[model samples]
Structure formats: C-alpha cells, structure tokens
Target: MRVAILAVQGAFIEHRKKLESLGAECIELRKKEDLEQPFDGLILPGGESTVQGKLLRELEMYDSLKEKIESGMPVLATCAGLILLAEHLSNDEHVYFGTLPVTVRRNAYGRQLGSFHTDAEVKGIGEVPMTFIRAPYIETADEQVQVLAHVDDRIVAVQYGAQIGLSFHPELDADSRIHEKFLGLIADCIKNNNCRKN
Candidate 1:
C-alpha cells in the first residue's frame, strides 16, 4: 500500500518513518501534483496552520484536496493539520483545509510551553501517550465523527468515516498503532473500491 504524507511542513518525516515501519510504501508530498488519487491514503502532519494555509494557496492543492476527501479518501490529520481539516476554524481565513465537520481552536493548548505529554486510551490503539504541542482543541464534532480520545475533558482525537484527526502528535510517540489503524482503514477502502471496479 502506498501512503503519502503532506510534507509541506511539520512532522511528516516522522509519520513517514512510522508508516514505513508498518511495511507500507511511504511518500512525502512535496507538490500539488502529489495530491492525486490512487495513493492508498494521505497524512496531514502537525504544523503551524497559518503557514500551511499560505503554502496550500501557493501550491494549489487546496481545492483538489477538498475533492479527494469528499470522494471518501482516508486521511489522518494531526495538530494544526486537524485545524485545517475542520469546517469551522476559529482563525477564519487562516483556516485552509476545511474538509471535516467540526470547528477548531488553534493554539488552544497555548505555546511551546503548552507542549506536554499525556496518555489517552485510543479506541484502536489502546492507551497510547500523546504529545500535544500548540495543538488545536476540538470545539465541536459532527454526529458521524466518533470521539476516539480525550484530553482533560476535551476531544483530542476524532474519526469521521475514513478520516481521523488528532489534537496531539501521535508521531512523537513510540507507538505506531494509530498509523497502523489508519493504514488498515485505507487498505479496506482500497479493497472495497477494487471490488466495485470488478
């Protein structure tokens, strides 16, 4: 299975390594053309939301990405990546990738000092440690979005259909279960699509 990590900026390198450890072909997305369909799945890594927004505008992947998600492509977004995927971002125009049905509060956990580690019982991964660095706190999620993990009574990880978003950095942890779970979902979707084609 081929997996692409949006490497415009952020912890994509770590995600690539983690996914590679799972025996998947990992690709680091560097240009708009990299967003094309047929890749098994995509990963939007943690980074500064505003910066990513500017990059998306420059690269011209914003609309294409929207279309991909709408077509049921499986994705996993982390940190500011989560903020971008949110439908109602608190930052207005700064919000670029509004693909998921939710609002996001950027830097809700504060600055770098807010960077801390905590443990949460992820539904598929069990109790895994999460590293939150200036993470966006989820304000609301659609009914279809399943709350996966929480931090201090706030939703930190959520899953809506084939997409998953996290308010913390799963790549920072030693655990690869989260990425494995996402890859599993991607594989299942690809298999179903192939069956339909046949």
Candidate 2:
C-alpha cells in the first residue's frame, strides 16, 4: 500500500517512519505536484492547525486534498489534523476540509503543558497508548460518525466513512495498531472498489 503524508508542516516524519515500518511506501506531499502521485491513503499529522491550513492554501494543495477526502479517500488524521477534517469548531470559527461530520474544540486540553499520555481502548483496537499534545476533542458528531475511543469521558477518536480522526498522537507511541488499522481501511476500500480518485 502507498500513503501520502502532508509534510508541509507538523510531525509528519514520525508518521512516515511508522507507515514505512508497516511495509507501506510513504510519500511526502510538499507541493501540488506531489499530490498527483498515486497514493492509496493519506495521513494528516499533528501540528499547528492554523499554520498547516495556511501553508496548504499558500502552497495550493488544500482544494485537491479536500476533494480526495470528500471522495472517500482513506485518511488518518491526528490532533490538529482532526481539526482540519472537522465540520465545525466549537471554540474556533475556522474550518478546513469540513469532511468529517463532527464538531471539535481546538486546544480543549488547555495549553502545551496540558499534554499527557494514557492507555485507552480504541473500539477495534484495545488499550493502546495515546499521547495528547495540545489536542482537540470532539464535542459532538453527526449521527453517522462512529465513536471509536474516549478519554476522561471526552470523545477522542472517531471514524466517519473512510476517515479516522484522533485527538491524540498515535504515531508518537511505539504501538502501530492505529496505523495498521488505517492501512486495513485502505485495503478494504481498494478491495471493494470504493477508493476514489480526485
């Protein structure tokens, strides 16, 4: 399987290392031309959402990536990446892709000092390490969005269609189950002919 990582900003290299370790060819998408490459899935890593969003637009890669997500392309988004996919931000007005039918509160855990680590039961994957760094949690979701995991009674992981959104950094942990689950999603989409091109 081949996956594209949004490398314009954020902790993308770690994601690349994880996916590559799982036998997937990884591509760093830094320019519009990079988006033209054939990739079975996409990863939006944790970082400053505002800066990532701004860079995506400034670099002319936003619209195409959004189109792919809307067209059912498999995506694994973490932290600020979740903010990019959220349809609404309860605390912030800016919305990036608006592909995931959920509402998120940016920096809901407070500041960088609010960051913490915990082991949680993620629906299909049991008890995996979750690292939250200035993360955002889902406040509400549409009827179709599936709640995958929760921390401290707050929604932290969700799946809507082919998109998997997480409030914590699974990539930062040693466990690769989350990334494996995402690859499985991509494989399923391809096998079922549900994977679409933008």
Candidate 3:
C-alpha cells in the first residue's frame, strides 16, 4: 500500500514515519502534481490552516483535491488538517476548504498555554492518549457522518465516509494503531471498488 502525506509544513514527517513503520510506502506530497499522483490514501498533517490554504491555492490543488476526495480517496486529517476538511466555519473568519460535513470551532479549547493531553476512547482504537494543542472541536456533524470519539462531551474524532478528521494529533504518539486502522480503511475502499469493477 502507498500513502501520500501532505508535506506543506506541519508534523507530516511524524505521520509519514508512523505509516511507513506499518509496512506501507510513504510519499511526501509537496506540490500539486503530488496530489495528482496515484496513492492508496492521503493524509493532511496538522498546521496553520490559513497558511496551508494559501499554499493549496498557490499550487492550484484546492479544486483537484476536492474532486479526488469526492471520488473516495481516503484522507486522514488532524488538528489544522481537520479545519481544512471542515464544512462549517467557526465565525472567526478563518479560511477553510469546507470539505467534510462538519462544523468546527477553531481553538475552541483555548490558547497554547491551555494545551492538555487526555485519554480518549476512540471507537475502533479503544483508549488512547490524545494530544490537544489549541485544537478545534467538532460542534456538529451531518447525518452521514459518524463520530468516533469525544472528550468533555465535545467531539474530537469523526469519520465521514472515506475521510477521518481529528482534533488531536495521533501521529505524535508512539501508537501506530490509528495509522494502521486508516490503512485498513483504504484497503477496504480499494477492495470494494475492485469488486464493483469485476
């Protein structure tokens, strides 16, 4: 299996290393052409959404990624990556791609000093230590989406079809289960598609 990790200035290297350890071919995607290339799955690493959005626009990949994701390209987005996949804005006027049908409030957890780590019971992954740094929360989810985990009654992880959005950075931890689960999802998508073709 091959996975593309968006290397637009974030903790992408961490994610890439974790995914690679899972026995998958890892590719760092920097330019628009990278997104166009074939891959079993893609991961959008956490970073400043505004900055990443600008880069996406400059590379002319905003629309192309939107189209590819719609065609069942599985994506795993964390923190600022979650913002990139959000559909509803926080009213703070921060730019977003509005990809997933999720309502996000940027930095709803407070500032950098308010960063905290907690144990979240992600549905498929069980209990795992989650790192939250000025992370946003999923306030609302469309009917088609299924929430995976929550903390303090606030949604932190969600899955919408082929996409997984998280307010915490799973790659920051030593656990590779989350990354493995994602690969499984990508494999499932591919298998289903091949079955349809056959």
Q: How many clashes would you count in candidate 1?
A: 0
Clashes of each: 0, 0, 0
Q: What tens digits encode model 2's per-residue C-alpha lDDT throughout 82-196?
A: 9999999999989999999999999998865479999999998899999999889999999999999999999999999999999999899899999999999999988998776
Residue 140 lDDT (model 3): 93
Give candidate 2's error at residue 177 in angstroms: 0.6
Q: Which residue pairs collide in model 2, if any?
A: none
| Pairs with steric clashes in candidate 3 | none
lDDT string, candidate 3, 1-198, tens digits: 788888877889999889888898988878877765668787898988878888888988787777767777888999989999898866556555677998899888766535888997999789998998888899999988999999999999999888999999999888778888899988998887731111
Give the TM-score (vs. native) of candidate 3.
0.93
What order do candidates take by TM-score, descending?
A: 2, 3, 1
User: lDDT scores for all predictions?
Assistant: 0.82, 0.93, 0.84
The global Cα lDDT (0 to 1) of model 2 is 0.93
User: Model 1 over residues 52-91: C-alpha lDDT tens digits?
Assistant: 8788779987777767777788889999789888988775
Residue 147 lDDT (model 3)? 93
